[model samples]
Target: MRIVEVYQSVQGEGLLTGTACVFVRASGCNLRCWFCDTPYASWRPEGVDLTIDEVVAKVEEWDCQHVVLTGGEPMLFSELIPLTQQLANRERHITIETAGTLYLPVACDLMSISPKLSSSAPALASNPHWHRRHQRERCRMDVIQRLVREYVYQLKFVVDRPADCQEIEEYLAALEDIDRERILLMPQGTHPDELADRTGWLAPYCQIKGYRFCPRKQFEWYGTVRGS
Candidate 1:
């Protein structure tokens, strides 16, 4: 796998927030979101390539129970199947953070699916290719359905504006068997003030819509630094 940095950090988002965990960030993505916080992992992927054994050995270096297999999109790599299997065999709680656009029958304790919204696409004038590609590949209901059905999952959306709330509603209506409680609405920002501004309305919206309000605690804890 093309591996990025592997480090220890607390669960900064989702239901497992605040939990101590080790992060394995794979470098590369299938889609490009304009507001991507980890641009190094996605927009311009950077990292060394590592075999499954090397990756596993590095993960075992941390004395943590939870392991987050995150990425520019971890599902892009086929090596995850055996990598996750190895982690699971060692009894580490495995969480795979993906965009939910791809599927892999890997061992995952939590399938943290963050489906990109239409607004996540880069502007057409700025990057026409990625804008069209992002729109085309962002949503995959079939992939989402299979992921949710196969694993314990959470659907997280990054809300940038009030209009996004309605889009999320329409999105959920189109999908089947989604647990609203497992749907998390997080503000789209890497800075504290930016997150705070969106949180004011986004938190209330999540409450009214019966979805979980997710905060980017990493920003608060580490201030948008890499390898948090």
Candidate 2:
């Protein structure tokens, strides 16, 4: 599997937020979001290839019990089936962060699904190819249903604008059995000021809509730096 930086950091998003965990960021993604925070793992993928054992060894380096198999879309690598199994055997709480666009029958404690919104598409003028492909492949409702059904999950939608909230509502309407409390609406921005501005309104909306208001605490805790 292609591996990016593996480090121990407090869980910065989703239901696991504030918990210390080991992050195994697999390189390469099936879709490109314009606001992607980890561009190194996506747009211009970079990493060293490692055997599944090697990846497990790295995660074991930390004393942390929570292990997040995040990506570039970790589901893109079939190796995750055994990789997640190995981690589970070691008694680590596994969280797989994905775009909810693919499916792999891997063991996981939390399936952190961040279904891409239409607003997340990259500018067509700058990158027409990825813009088209991203839109085409971003939402796979079948995969979303499977992931949520197979694992304890959280649905985190990046709210870039007020309009995005309505889109999220429409998105959720298509699915069944989704717990409203597990649905999180997070502000979209790398900077604190931008996040604060959106949060002012987004937080209230989430409250009225009965969804969790997820704050990107990593930015406040460590700025927009990598390995947070």
Candidate 3:
């Protein structure tokens, strides 16, 4: 597996926010989000490829009980099957953070699926190639449905505007057996100031809609720097 950074930190978003955890950020992505905070792991990936044993060793170095298999898009790697099994054997609570476009059968305590919205696409003026590719690859309802049914899951959406909220509703309606309470709406931003600005209205919107409102607690507590 190509590993980006393995570090101990609090779960920053979705249902597990504030939980102390070891984050294993896999370094690659299938879609490019314009607001990606970990661009090093996505838009331009960087990391050393490690065997499952090496990656497991690094994770064991942390004293945390919860482990997040996050990405660029962790589900992209076939190595995750063995990696996740190894982690589960060690009895670590596992959370897999994925774009929800791909599905892999693996052990996961929480499948944190953040399906990219149309707003994630970069403008044509910015990067036409990624803009097109991102739009084409972002949403896969079939894969999402399977993921939700097969695992304990949460559907987390990054909300940049009010229109994005409507898009999420339409997506949920299309998905079968989706629990609305498992849906989390998080403000889109990498910095505290930007998060605050979006959270002002986004949080209330979530409240009114009865969706769980997620905050970027890591950015709030540790700022936007890497290894948070």
Candidate 2 minimal-lDDT segment of 10 residues: 9-18
lDDT of 1: 0.94
Writing each residue's lDDT as its tens digit, candidate 3 over 143-189 gives 99999999999999999988998899899999999888899999999
Q: Which pairs clash in the backbone of model 1?
A: none
Q: Order the numbered candidates by lDDT, best leading.
A: 1, 2, 3
How high is the CA lDDT of each candidate model? 0.94, 0.93, 0.92
Kindly list the per-residue Cα lDDT of model 1 for residues 80-152, writing each as its tens digit. 9999999999999999999999999899999999999999999999999999999999999899999989999
lDDT of 2 at 51: 99
Question: Where is model 3 more than 4 Å wrong at Cα?
Answer: none
Backbone clash total, candidate 2: 0
Backbone collisions counted per model: 0, 0, 0
For residue 61, model 1's alpha carbon misses the true position, in angstroms, by 0.5
Task: Return the TM-score for each candidate structure.
Answer: 0.98, 0.98, 0.97
How accurate locally is residue 39 in candidate 3, as Cα lDDT from 0 to 100?
91
